[model samples]
Target: MAARPEPMTPTGGRLAIIAGGGRLPHHVAEAAREAGEDPFIIPLTGEADGDWTGFDHEPLFVGDFAGVTRAFRARGVDRVVLSGGVRRRPDWRGIRPTIPFLFRMPRVVSTLLKGGDDTVLKMVIDLIESAGARVVGVQDILPSLLAETGPIGAVSPDDAALADIRAASEAATALGRLDIGQGAIAVGGRVVALEGPEGTDAMLARVAGLKAEGRISARRRGVLVKLCKPQQDVRADLPSVGPATIENAHAAGLAGVVVEAGRALVLDRRAVIGTADRLGLFLAGIERETMA
Candidate 1:
């Protein structure tokens, strides 16, 4: 077995969480607090959950680039974590760019218009780092959330399901290589669905529709595969799944879900496992080499 990477040590400085959406930001905050590091949350308005009352938090719009930088400097934050989801692109008209943003405005605009999601994310990371704060991956603070290799829950994929897993994985990786999306579904060794901008849930919903329409054989189940994009910056935007994912896969009549071990986040793992078990669905985490 390959050795797990060492957990990152807390910086001991105030940690700022650039909250987006979903339960991930909350998980990261709890993990940071448990590590004895003070956590300050800077939630992106509309995207972030409003349950961050106890922590030192401020709600700021995602377009407010100036405000975010100022918050980090004012709060004495040295380390930052960008967590959760942000489905909508920021409206540029609403933003009040800081001097740094202004200085890099040309490059930023060019990247936003011409580059893919990964390029845009890399630019965002560059912007944050240029502002004198270190951006850390969510896995660094919440290593336990990293999906473990092999099968999870009571159900395991059968040989046919495994074949579908491999097929779906190849499709998903091909999509990732193009910086398109991170998920794909396969039935009976044939690709059935590919995730687009609508995301995994929506992709599964489409598969469910196909299954209902008799396009897919009701007796033959499939697998959903999600993994990091090839050449993706691992420090941000790793693929994730939770209880809802399992429920959706079950609804779509998928036999299992496969993720990249040590590279994907398993949100609410206990609940996810329980749901998978109850639904008789397998959740497997395969190593990157297997996918390769």
Candidate 2:
């Protein structure tokens, strides 16, 4: 295990977590509290988990940009973290843009119309920073969530599995460069599936269907490769996997899962490892150079 960095001191004022769905935001809030900061949360409606009720949180629609900014300013928050999954874009018609949101409206509209996910995220980060708050990566508050390079379970990938890993990694990276998606699957050195906007679990489920339909040879299993998009701003939207990912991979009949070391989030690390071990699936994290 790597030595963990000391928790950041709370000198920059209270942290504001703009939370979406999944366990990550809850984890971030808990970690922040451990670090002596009472983090406030702005949970997006229909996206955030209910676990946030114990924290200082207000539920708002994802499109409520003005409301989020006003809440942060009112709470005297100066540092921010964006965490978790937002699978859907907000309904634009219902949004009532605040003055600050209006100032950035043109650029936001342009990005929404022309740019990809990464571009939209970069603009959102800019919007938050424009409100005079510093945006930090979730890993900054919870370093242990960052995956280290190496095998992480009882089973390790063999030579064949490693080849699949390499092929899948390259394919995933290429897709990422186009800002399309962050995951791909390779079986016997052949690309089997590429993740689209549906996300990783859905991609894996598709792979399972392929296997059931005999589209993928039953004799050959694959590895799922997930990485941070090459052009992605690492401070937000890092690729993440958890125990559920392991379950999905096993169901897909995959031999293992691979991720970029130090750039991906591994949530519930212990549970993820335990699940992989029980299912006889390998989980490895490799350096970017290894994929090249």
Candidate 3:
């Protein structure tokens, strides 16, 4: 059985939510606000988009790597609630990098290329902390958002689907280690889709089409697996699942989801699990090493 995480206790301090695109960032920001913490949001250019003013925190655009650090400093951010999709690649083209960022880019990119996600992001966290701030989990400030363990829904995979789940889990973790992709969809023990820059929904939708076109051969529904890259810095980001994940899985005719336990997050746990249950999607989390 997967462990059910407890709701977070409110830790007081102004939390700077450095947000990027995706539901998780917004979820964290909302969770922080509901906890009565002073929530500030900084939207990374090309990543986070929404009504900034409604969040009740001033939104600043930080593009270059150096600008991000300065943005936090300017807002008196002592602790940060790091959340959502800050692209590792997409933001590079147009960035007007500050001098500091340019000087550090070689080291950062070198780490990314030669090391795992953990290696690359740890360098980043080190950079942030060196600038006199702390980086903490979304759960630290938003405990209720942690994903709980259990069967989320009624419909689990049939025997063949379970096989696919197992295979998908293995492949997904391997890919994560290589920094290839976080998610992979498999049918009949073969990879049908591996998540690319377009994200999970796109991956699922495309694989569903492939299955319809007779490219995949699973007798039952497909299986989807997302993983935290092995050696990833847990403090910064982990692969996440939520209501949206389960919904997308079902739409793609998938039977279940497998994420790295403790290393992955389930946002809106109750609603996500309940929806998965209602939709007959199996939800499971695993440790990265053991599962791999």
Candidate 4:
């Protein structure tokens, strides 16, 4: 990890976490609270950790786009961090919209119908910014989370692992195009586990269990794919992994990590790499088409 810039004096006061889903949001909120800045949490309803007792302040839950904005506004939070995302698509069935959401239908539908993740996320960013709130990516708040440059394992790929890494990277992008998920674990050219709403850790646990049961090999020949959705809204739900992933792979007795070269975030890169290196795990930032 690069030397963290001395945290710019908390930009006045509290840190607002526009948390969606996954462990990263919880991690970020806890960090913000420990920094002496009260964290204003806005959980994405079914998508976030609504029981956020770790944070210094209360949390508000919003199930829709309109509600999300208003709840953040209510907190009087001008600075915010976009951490993680809810994995499931909204169940719009039987759901009624608020008047404002109804009024903004044209703009919202126009973007959703005509755009990909990037377009939609950019629109959300604009919406939040217009509310006198500055929406920032997790990087803006935690530079220490990004991975550093270099191979992270004690034993670099001895050819076989490299081959699996290449294959998994390609496969991940193919899966991503369908918005299936951002990660998968494979063994000897076969897909062993695909990440679901349970996220990476659960997937890792399952694969490890399979290995223990003699269903797969526990060696460098294993494959891991961390990728971005083909139609990603980079400003929002881009794929990210950190030291916990490395720790997971190690516990699972896996071989390597293959993340989308430019589009993925290797959160806590230095520590992740160091841990991977210590475990003899191979790490590769691979190109999609090339792997495909």
Candidate 5:
């Protein structure tokens, strides 16, 4: 494993997390607190799943730009982090834009209707920055969560598994370049599945179904790979893996999983390692260029 990088010092002013579904926002909040900063959380309605009982938090809908801006300004927030999964986009008609933003509503609607995930995220970042807060990536707050180079757990990929990894990595990169998805699955050096809007979990489930039906070779194990988009902003939606990922990969009859080192987030690191080890699954962090 590569050595962990030193933690970054939090920039001046209060930190705010635009939290969505999952433990990631909570993790970021904990990291911010550990760094001697109290973080205010704006949990998206229906999207944020965890209890935010102890943290200073406010609930807002997905498209409440005016409310989010007001909350940031009220709490003297200058650094904002967007984390976790948003399963669905908000309805344009339901969005509450600020006066200035309202003027740009036409463009916003157009982008929402026609743009890919990357384009939509860039627009969101622009809107957040326009509200006078700097949008930061979860990586900026907790560098240790990033996958380091080499094996993440005890098991290591074999030659065939490594070949699968390389194949899936290339496929994932292409998928990302199209602003489509971040994950791909391969078996015996043949790409089998590419993640789409339904996400990695659903994609893996598809693979499992295919395997069960004797479509993909039941004899040969596969590998799953996740990578950053070629033109991604990186601050909003970096690929993430966790214990669930290991479980899913095992269920999918995969031999291993690989993610781009330093570019993907590994949630609940110890748990992920334990799960990977228990399941006898190889979890490696590879450099994309090295694999190429």
Candidate 6:
């Protein structure tokens, strides 16, 4: 396991959210507001799908490192929280960096062209820090979003589901160690699907397709497991689940869903639990230490 960076204090200076598509960013913004801090949102153009009405924000392209730096300086932003889903990586040849970023462009290009998601995120964090802003995870701003150990709702995993969880959890951890992805699915104690660059929803869709085609056994349902990568910088890119996840899991014909306890985020907790319970599926937060 990798040592996580010490959490940065949320106090002092203006806070900014480098937003992407999904409800997580909105949740962070709302939490910041509830804490009496007005968050400035920098929604990535073409990537941020949520409505930003009434929130102070500016839109920027994903490759516009220079623009992001300028925004940070202009807004006096010293604390940044990265949230939501970024489906696209910038086109290397099209990146237009300036000033300090101009000097770092070579290294940035190398990492973007050669690195995995985790490496890319680390590079982004370094850039944010270089601009004098400390990067924090969504969990830091709203600890309530962190998934706790045990069942999340009315249902608990059966023995068969537990076995699938164990198999999938190990597979997820292994996949993360390689910086491949954070999710996997197992059926009857056998790994059946792995999340890739395309992400969790798409992966679940693939499982659904397999089940529909009669590839996966209709009688033996599976389980989806998500965990933080062994060497991940938990300050960013932690595995997350939400109502959509439960819906997809049900659609995928899975028996349950499991995530690393205290190390994953559950977006819209009530909705997630309600969806799981309503759909007759289990949602569990399992500690990695107990997986063995």
List the candidates' TM-scores in order: 0.96, 0.96, 0.81, 0.68, 0.97, 0.95
Per-residue CA lDDT of model 3 for 39-91, tens digit only, reads: 77877766787767776454445335556667766667777766877665423
lDDT tens readout by residue for model 2, 60-98: 898787787789889998999999999876555766577
Top-down TM-score ranking: 5, 1, 2, 6, 3, 4
Q: Clashing pairs in model 2?
A: none
Judge candidate 2 at residue 172 and give its lDDT: 93
What is the lDDT of every predicted structure here? 0.88, 0.88, 0.70, 0.66, 0.92, 0.89
True-structure lDDT of candidate 3: 0.70
Clashing pairs in 5: none
Model 3: colliding residue pairs = 8-143, 21-47, 118-233, 152-277, 153-277, 261-286
lDDT of 1 at 12: 46
Name the candidate, 3 or 4, with the larger TM-score value: 3
The list of candidate 5 runs beyond 4 A from truth reads 1-5
In the order shown, what is each candidate's alpha-carbon RMSD? 1.3, 1.6, 3.3, 5.1, 1.2, 2.6
lDDT of 6 by residue, 36-97 (tens): 78799999998898789988899999878778888889988989999988998888787767
Q: Residue 53 in model 5: shift from native, Å?
A: 1.1
Task: Tell me the tens digit of each residue's lDDT in model 1 across 1-292.
Answer: 3235666677746789999999999999998888888899988888997588889999998767788888888988888899999887665566678876788877777777777778888888888887789998999899888888889788899999989988998998899999889999999999989998898999999999999999988799999999899899988999999999999999999998999988999999999999999999999899867765
Give, for candidate 4, the lowest lDDT window spanning 10 residues.
Answer: 88-97
Question: How many pairs of residues in model 6 come into backbone collision?
Answer: 0
Q: Please give the lDDT score at residue 232 for candidate 6.
A: 97
2 against 5, candidate with superior lDDT: 5
